[model samples]
Target: MSNYIVRKLKLEKTPQLDHLARAAGELYSRTVVSFWRTVRKKNIWLSGYTMERWHTSSSLHAHSSDAIVQCFYNSLKSWRIRRKTDPHSKPPRRRRWYFKVIWKSAAIKLKGGKLRLSNGQSNSPLIVDWYWEKPSIIELGWNKASQCYELRACYKEEIAQPINDGNVAAVDLGEIHPMVIADGVNTDIFNGRYLRSVRRYQNKLKVRLSKLIDRKKFRSKRRKRSIKSKQKQLAKLNNQIKDIEHKLTSRAVSMLKLRGIQTLVIGDVRDIRNGLDYGKKNNQKLHQWSFGSIRIHLEYKCKKAGIKTVLITEEYTSQECLNCRKRNKPKNRNYRCSCSFEFHRDGVGSNNIRAKYLGIVPVVGLMARPSGLRFHSHIQCNLTDNILLGNPRDSIAGE
Candidate 1:
């Protein structure tokens, strides 16, 4: 529950350090590539991501004479880099070479509390790692050259049962409002106005930058500083948006806990990978509408409170009018159809969201069930390594 980072200074200003780093990067590539190639062949039926089903890789080594050596991490790497070894034979890779590990075994030894320090510095260059006991996974933070720092360590504590008088609130993610929230008992909770403003600023900046480029004035220091300023604004906007979500979501969660709402119900609004783009007019909006990132934040916060999030199928939760039982959701932002049924579009979609605190959805590739509905199609997938949802209070016990 406690979080702090361990930063160890490891700059050689020496060519030996550079050489060790290069060697390690090459070795890391060699090992990861061979593993992934075999993995790809083994899981031919799965998507590249789903290949984690067949084989999930762990770190490998590049041995060195020195017990302490450099380390590396490539966030999104090419498959070719993993296998290619003849440095002179292949074409240049867009992915740049960075830090990598050379003495992993020794590194592990240091991690286990062995004392090998000299000159009051860590004998081995540090590798940033994260361990969360609740969800139970160890993550390695890749070194970020931009800040000259790895995302080393972050302290995010899970609050167990933070409240007991609140009620279950279902927040629907949307295009305009960004977040449309409603308690299980029916109350409005929304946050998205600033998000819209941020979007506009981003668009304006993009247009301005584009104009400068067209005029061939892109090299001006003024333009560069302006762009940087815009980036800072974008970041500030992101923090504002997330802060709103956290406040609302956490309040809802706390309220639910207070009301004896043992389980918190939420929609699994994830990227279905069906070509969803927020229409990138420029660099800003493209980065702002980080769908994947939003979901991740929600999941992590929910996990801290031992809450359950139901990932209802994404096919038609919005359009299928929760009231009339009619599938009339529009692709655009409009909520009303030819029929006179007018409501806050997202609110209506959310009304149908059933508090599914049971097992998995039995039906695959079909419309997701709403909250408080009996679902025989419910089978449970483990959201976290420690928690499981097997029982149901609604009509379907098999759910």
Candidate 2:
């Protein structure tokens, strides 16, 4: 199968480049808004004719007009789709600064360490740093914080499909453990205690900052500065969280790849927090947990690695007993059944998730018991050291 991937590289910052980017973005946005107004007035959907009408009168640079039109069409398509589900969807609004410029093949020229970009007015190229080979589609965008432009190149390549080794790994995602993996033979647990602690600290810091900002008078310079500082801190914390998620997901995927596992069954909990009444603290934790983000990361990585990913409803995976096929309510992290079978709650969930695909009840007897269990922690915490249970086995017996 073939897939397209986008790579972003930081571009050198210059006042001239920044001004041009903003000017182009503003022009494109204005054109889009104008077309949207016309469509709304006529009660007609956006089409190439509507875009062509606006494009003819647009004062945007010739070099960027094609790209602007493409952007407008894409946005209008999205808005139309959204409006189908939501009649109240509004048209695109005006933006303060336009930040991106799309360049056609002829508009960009790359030679050695320098890039020549068309400024729309003349043949003279705007010089920028370039190291990688030129791509078919090039997009330049401005970064407000860094006061620089960014380069994004898009390309496609073929990827080999992963071979099916008949081994399957089921993942159970939770707030406490984060991720629990069972390949029908061995179990691996990824602890989330450190992540929770970091989140709590960040929340406390945000509250302290908010109080300090509120103590200042409204519209005061000191208050504005405090607000800016708080925003910066929040952005920094968000970046940190994203970095951690990327690393954890990568490690999990690497582990699966190493074991020659072909099928990955992930328990889907997308709407787990839809209308739960878990009180103040618990609700806050649930809202902050980035389950969706983790799933996305896992999916893309799996796709690129040629691994088949399946999502199954996780309704009773955690509550159902594996031994007697009876429903048992778990207390804390341990699940106990009336038949005298007991095991880690999340581990059982993982096993049952796999069973859903295999169409068989997982056996918990000594012969089919997991040979060993591995514990991994995302963060370096003394309390969550890796522990191995029983003797390690060559492969998980998924009978």
lDDT of 2 by residue, 1-399 (tens): 876556666778776666767766776766766666777798766676556556631333464666766676777679889998999987566554665777776777788767777766543457776555566667888654444677777656566776663688899887887778888777777767666776788899899999999999999999999998888787777767765666666667767777777889999999889989899999998998878888887787766666788898988989888888899889887888989988888899999998887888786663143322223334321121231111012012211
Name model 1 segments beyond 4 Å from true: 1-151, 154-169, 213-249, 268-290, 320-324, 327-342, 355-399
Go through the candidates in order and give the clash count of each: 32, 2
Clash pairs for candidate 2: 25-98, 185-396
How far is each candidate from the true structure, as Cα RMSD in Å?
Answer: 13.5, 7.9
Cα-based lDDT at residue 37, candidate 2? 73
Best by lDDT: 2
4 in model 2: Cα distance from truth in Å?
3.6
Error of 1 at 88 (Å): 18
